[model samples]
Each structure stands twice: as structure tokens, then as C-alpha cells.
Target: MSAFSKALRTLSAMAIALAIGVAASFTPAHADPNATLDRIKSSGVLKVPVMVGEEPGYVKDPATGNWSGFYMDWANDIAGFLGVKVQPVETTWGNLAADFQANKIDIAFGLNPNPKRGLVVDYLSVPLFTDAWAIVTKKGYEKKTWAELNDPSVRIVVQKGGTMQVVAEAMTPKAQIIPVEDRPLGVMELQANRADVMILAIFDAVQVSKQIDGQIILPKPMLINPATIGVKREDGNEGYENWLTNWINYQRSLGLAQGKLHQTFEKAGIDLSMLPPEFSF
Candidate 1:
């Protein structure tokens, strides 16, 4: 071959190699499908967050420092399925997304999926159960319609940073909206007669009403929402998510999840009949 032709061929080969390298540098990296599952197996622990001051979902005993609730049951089931131990991480509702981002918790149950939170974590498409908004009010308050509560004189209490607060703000804008830091405070406000009503999901309202001997009323135009599981967002974690989805589907199909909900409510000293007849989880 001529020297010029040989030189041209060598330069062409070098250009192709440089282009390949550049392309590879810009390519996005994908995680393995079993990445999360493998890690859980390797560590032998699945960390889950447990929230306090909520019955049926979570409750921390003051005397024993022990935790128990429906969520605990769920975590135990999941851990058992994976042959791992459950590590409970205490947290608040507002901190779940941050905790997931920080890799402090592996999964959280009964999270009401929202757009802002969706950016940080992945919510399983299948819901653990459905919940609806209800109002806990003093006896003889007698306002059944949300529109009736829209008056400025009505004081509506809701847990700050929760979907109940958003619903209160949107549906009863004219009412005096009181956002408390937690459920206990909101209940206190109701007990003190400082708030006319506290808006909470039916499960929470049921327990709170039982605590204070208040009445639980389903307001007109019920706001129904699904409570699903939330997990840390990671690439190629579909295998884990799919397994979870399938597990939930199987549990729901067999009424095991619903049975758990009933048992939890019963354990909390709440009668299922107290809920509105039309309501179904």
C-alpha cells in the first residue's frame, strides 16, 4: 500500500475509536434489575419507617417502647418473604421523602401519593387500601355537607403537610383552617372546642373520635384516596417493584390485606360498624 493511503487508514481508525469513546461517556448507566433485591438479601435487613400517634397504621407504646400496627404487620410479611429481618425507623409523615432520598428507609406503607413526592420516591401503582376523608366533630354540630363548612366561622383542623390539609384549603377556603403539626395536636384542638371540626381520613378520624368520644361524619362529596407503598427511587428496580406489586395483588385478591385492616381496627377498639355503610377499604 502507498504511504499516503496507509496514513489515511490509520487516521480513520483513530477517529472511529475517539467517537466511540465519546459516545460511551455520554451514555446513561442502568442499574441491575435485582439491584434492590440483591442488596436486601446481602444485608439481611429491610428497613421500614414507622410513624407514631396513628392507630391501625402505627402506634408506639409509651410503657414498652415497642411498636405495633398494620404497617408493622406489612413490614413483617415483606421481610419474611425476602428472608430478611425488619428494621423499624421512626419517622414523621413530612420526613418520608427526605428519608427515602437519604437512604434511611427502604419502604413506607400507607402513603397517599402526591405529585411533589412522586419526584423523589416511587409509589407502587397498587394501593394498600382506599381511604376517604371524614370530619370529626362535637356532638350536635350536625353539618353533613362540606359546603356548609365553607363559612368563615367554621374552624377546620388538619394535620399540616398532609393531604387533609390540602383538601381543607381547597374545599373550605373561607373557613378558618388550622393546620397542626401532628394528629394529637389536632385532636387536642377539637377537644378544647378551639376547632369546630378536624378533617382526617376515615381510619384516623374513627380512632380519634373513639379517643375523645366525638362523632364521625362523612361530609358530602366524599374525597376518596388510595394509600399505597412508597419506596426509594432507583434505576432498574422494576424487579423489586414488580414483585411487590404482585404480592399486593395476591394479598388483595385473597382479602388478606382487608382482613388485616379489620383486625387492626378491631385491635384499636374501633367497631367497623361505626364507619359509613357505603365505605369499603
Candidate 2:
């Protein structure tokens, strides 16, 4: 080889080695991959945040102040594995990232993942399940199809700071999108006839139907989203993320996901007309 060519090759080799050295320095030789796991173990408290306002998936009982729902049960199951007492905290569909940022909670119980949400938190690689969004309205209301709800006169209630807001705006471009702080408040709007409809998951809408006299979640959902547990982005240490991810896999291996879905469905009294097939297996 020419002298110039040999010199260029030498320089490239040095650069590559320097880059590898810098990357190696980022992770100290003695750093622990299970730091988060060890910390939670020592604390003996796993502070889990659940959506107190969203039912059939996560909610706090008004009478007992105890939390129960699909996600709450899942969190309890996780706490069992970690050998820690679950400290259930009340959270809403929105403000998950804010609570995580403030270090007030370790994880959120139930919610779907989106690109916008992905920017703030890290979700498990294996999704817990798929949730399809549908139209919920009064029993006698005539707006059946998604197309019918696309008029400016249609009042669509959406949970603020959640993906439902984006879904409602996109589905009904000309309709009035009324934002509420929580799912129950949105259901209340529909119950009082203050709002024409609210777009939400069948699981949640079913729970709300029991609370309202005449509201019904129609079949034919428009949006399907994958739901999972979320951890703070920066706090997604291998110890924390890996344990949760593997737990999801382990639960599915035991065929618990399907059974859990059915149990919640039974509790919500929601039929399987438009529910996704993945809900079963």
C-alpha cells in the first residue's frame, strides 16, 4: 500500500478505538445493572399510580377508598413478585408524565402508548393488550356512525392530556371537542346531556354505562391502541424496565392475560361485540 493510504488507515483505527473508549467510560466498570431493583427491594414499598377516575381498568372505590380494576390487579401482582407492599396512588389519564417527573410515583398502572407519550416515558416492549376506542352516547341518541359524529353541532367529550383528545379531534374535525380532567367527568357530561358523545375504550365506556342511566357505548370502534405499563424515561434503568417487561412475558406465558381480560369484562358487564380479538388471547 501507498504511504498515504497506510496513514489514513492508521488514523481511522485510532478514531474507532477512541469512540469505543468513550462509550465504555459512560457505563462505569462497577455500575450495577440492577440498581433500581435493589433500591425498591430495600424500600419495601412499590408506589403504583392508578387511574382513579377510569373504571373497569383502574378506579378507587368511593365507599372503601381502596383501588380495584384491571391495572390495579396487575400492579398488585407485580408487587407480589417484588415482595413489596403496594402503595396505590390516585392518578388520572393525564398527568402521568408530570407525576413521574416529580418522583411522586414509580409507575402508572394502565394506559396506551403513543409517539407523544413515548417521548416522555418508556413503555414495555411487550404490550399488555390492545384497547379499541368507540363512540359512547345516550341510549336514544341517533348519531351512530363515526361519520355522523363529524358535524360541528356534535359535542364530543374527551379526556384532556390523553390520547383520546387527539383521537377525538382527528375523528370529528368539525365537532366541538370538550376536554375534561378525568374520565368520570367526561361521562358526567354525557349523562347530563351537556355533551353529545365521548370517545373512549369499550372497557371504560362499559363501566361508565353502569353509572349512567341511559348512556351506551356503540359497536364499531374507530381507533385501536396498545396499552402497557410506563416508567419515567430517565428512570428506565435496566433493573426496573427489564423486570416489568419480563413480568409481562411471564404472565402471558401462564395465560393470565386472557383470563384477566375476561374477568374485567365480566366485572364491567361489557359484551364482546366490537372488542378486539387480541383481548381473548
The runs of at least 3 residues in candidate 1 whose Cα sits more than 4 Å from the true structure, single-residue gaps closed, are 1-3
The CA lDDT of each predicted structure is: 0.88, 0.76
The TM-score, computed over Cα atoms with residue i paired to residue i, of candidate 2 is 0.80
Q: Evaluate model 2: give its lDDT.
A: 0.76
- Per-residue error (Å), model 2, residue 273: 6.1
Candidate 1 per-residue lDDT over residues 72-107, each given as its tens digit: 998999999999998989877777889999989988
Against the true structure, what is each candidate's TM-score? 0.93, 0.80
Top-scoring candidate (TM-score): 1
